[model samples]
Target: MIRDVAVLALEGSHAFELGVFCEVFGIDRSDDALPGYDFALVSATGDSVSTRHGFDVRTPHGLERLSSADLICVPAYDLRVRQPDRLAHELRAAAERGARVLSICTGAFLLGEAGLLDGRRCTTHWRYTDELARRHPRARVESDVLYVDQDPIITGAGTAAGVDTCLHVVRREHGSAVANTIARRMVAAPHREGGQRQYRERPQPREGTGSLAPVLGWIEANLDQNLTVEAMARHAHLSPRTFARRFQQEAGTTPLQWLTGQRVLLAQHHLETTDDPITAIARCTGLGTVDNLRHHFVRRLGITPQGYRRAFRAPHNK
Candidate 1:
């Protein structure tokens, strides 16, 4: 549903966050059955905008370009820099008109300046969550999550999480199939739950203790099995309590939570690529039954399994 995409190019904007928006929406991928967006880089100043890296990006579009945008990004900028009030006003106007306004990293501050974060559950980078809360006290700052999707106002946490945040919008607007295709092309994870922790002590397992790396691969390969924390703990040669603690430390979420997210992802793929009924997918994904499948599909994707298949079933399968 989102076609017109515009990102603000402000002075001292973080290059990577700006590139995240450009990568997700700006590129034309129609050859891969994914169409590009009507994208623009809008700046409050003139065509040339300086980045934090000391490079300049030229974008002829200006603030007025935001008027027709279905999605607008306030990409990360210097946290200390003061943005123009008019920019904030335009962002508010965009939200009022039902356009989704997304903020990556510290860009949430600009949204706060626009009064868009008030009464909305939002977030920023983990390091700045406290500051975001202190500045925008009315905003509910969910500090640790990768991103917070408050519908018309979406906020992403630090740098790489921007990819997750943008792909989430892509998934919601198009379907998991489109989002997954985009992810595959980018060589990124197909999906990461927005509620997943933004920070983790160990992204990979510690060298000495049994590595969760292999355990994760095993879990993925055997998703149809009835997996439990105790079972996983045994496989890791660890006590259940220790495994649970280590999982939280390493994965940034509980074991079962990660398991469910993986199950849902598999179900999404099945629904898109196969003609099998929901019951079959449920069993194959370890979701057990049609009722359970529908429950998770609706809860996680905001669409029923049947509806997802209808919208995103591959052309050959359909």
Candidate 2:
């Protein structure tokens, strides 16, 4: 149903991410027996724009093109710089009229600035995750995933994750068969699980002062263990009260909350990648029972465990 797409290119945009938009949607793929998308690169001022890569490109279409698009993509931007308020307003208007809005990498910061990401789930580059969370307290930031597809508004993690997000859109709009055909032509993987972790070479604890590294590493390894705030505090060699406060300050969440989140992540992985039943997954993740797991899963993900498995299970398994 998404036949028309418009990508917003601003001054100082990352050329590579913008090119990802063009490569995935701009090219005429009809010859490859794929349904072609009507794609346009539009600018705020309808003039030639210089990319961060030192190249220039012209766009005749202006903000008006965004209004007619079924989907709009805002690729990476330099968040340290200022974005025009008028362009943000136009992007918000398009979203208000039901256009699907997507952002890649630091593009999520632009969406946050436009007030579109408020109270929604989103993720940007992991390095900027803290800043995004600080700026938009309403957004539920999930830093680990390759992307977060919250329906009408979707966001991807750092650079290369953009490809996964775009392919996901293609899959949702045209079905896996068509998306796979395009991927084959592009010589890219047909699908990459969006929930996969954004790779970090060495993820350090929040502050370099003292590490919460040992506690976090222990929690991850013992996901099947019943981890409570009191237990975790003892493990970290702090009193329950001090540990609860420090954990919130350092990890941005309480010990129990973080533990529960980790368990859910583990459960999700098994649901998507394994043939295990919901009951088995519940037990494996220490969620105890299927009903309990379903309750927590739905509360966190807005989808039941079974529904998630059905949507993302490998094709052969399906």
Candidate 3:
């Protein structure tokens, strides 16, 4: 459903965030049987824009291009710079006309300038979250989440989270298969829940850093088994309460939450690649029954297990 895409190229834009939009929407991946978006880099200020890295990117398109866009993406720009009034007006108009708008990192400030963030739940980079909240007191700015999909206005936390947010919009509009294909070509994770924490500041604690790396591997390898926090605690050689605290400190998520996410991911893989029945897939993923699987699938993914299979199953299987 989201074929037409436009990215606003403001002065001092972060190249990586711009590249994220370009990689997800600009590239022609039709050869791989993926949908090719009608994409444009629209200059919000002028034809020539200077990036934060001290380079110039000249775009032929302008604010008028946003008129036809199904989705308009705003990449992070220098937070200190002010957005042009004309650009803000155009963005507000586009949203008013039912176009979905997405902001990556500090770009949420532009949405705030357009009065779009008022009374809306939104977010920006973790480093800028407090500032964003302070500036727009009416906006419910969640600091920790990867992204917030508030319908018609999605806001990503920071640089890499933009990929997660864009893929989510694609999956919502076009189906998981198309989103997955794009993600594969980009060598990125196909899905990361919006509720997941944006691990800021600290390097993610990993195998060599006293993390539950082996326990995580074991859990993934045995998703079919009924994984319990107490069981995982025993495996990690710690009391349940201590293990829970350590897991949160090291993994940025609770043990049970991570286990459910892994099982759901496994179920998604099976749904996409195999013709296994729902009941069989459910059992294999430790979801217990088809009903239980459907409940979690719908809760986490916003689609039924059968619907996900139908949308993402191999062509031959279909």
Please name the candidate that would achieve the greatest TM-score relative to the true structure: 1
Model 3 superposed RMSD (Cα):
2.3
Over 4 Å off in model 1, which ranges? Answer: 205-209
Segments of candidate 2 deviating more than 4 angstroms: 200-318
Report, for every candidate in turn, its global Cα lDDT versus the true structure.
0.90, 0.83, 0.87
RMSD of each: 1.8, 8.1, 2.3
lDDT of candidate model 1 versus the reference: 0.90
- Model 2: lDDT of residue 190: 67
CA displacement after TM-score superposition, residue 165 of candidate 3 (Å):
1.9
Q: Please give, for residues 1-318, the per-residue lDDT of candidate 1 as tens digits.
A: 788999998888999999999999999998887868999999997587989998999988989999999999989999767777899899999999999999999999999989999999999999899999999999999988989998899999999999999999998887788898899989988888899889888774644556688888889999999899999999988999999998889878899989999999999888878888788999999999999989988887788999888887867767
Per-residue lDDT for 159 in model 3?
92
Model 2 C-alpha RMSD vs. true structure (Å) is: 8.1
Task: List, residue by residue over 51-105, the lDDT tens digit for candidate 3.
Answer: 9999999888978899999999999999777768888899999999999999999
- Once fitted onto the true fold, the runs of candidate 3 whose alpha carbons sit more than 4 angstroms away are 174-181, 200-202
In model 1, the worst 10-residue window by lDDT is 202-211
By the TM-score metric, which is better: model 1 or model 3? Answer: 1
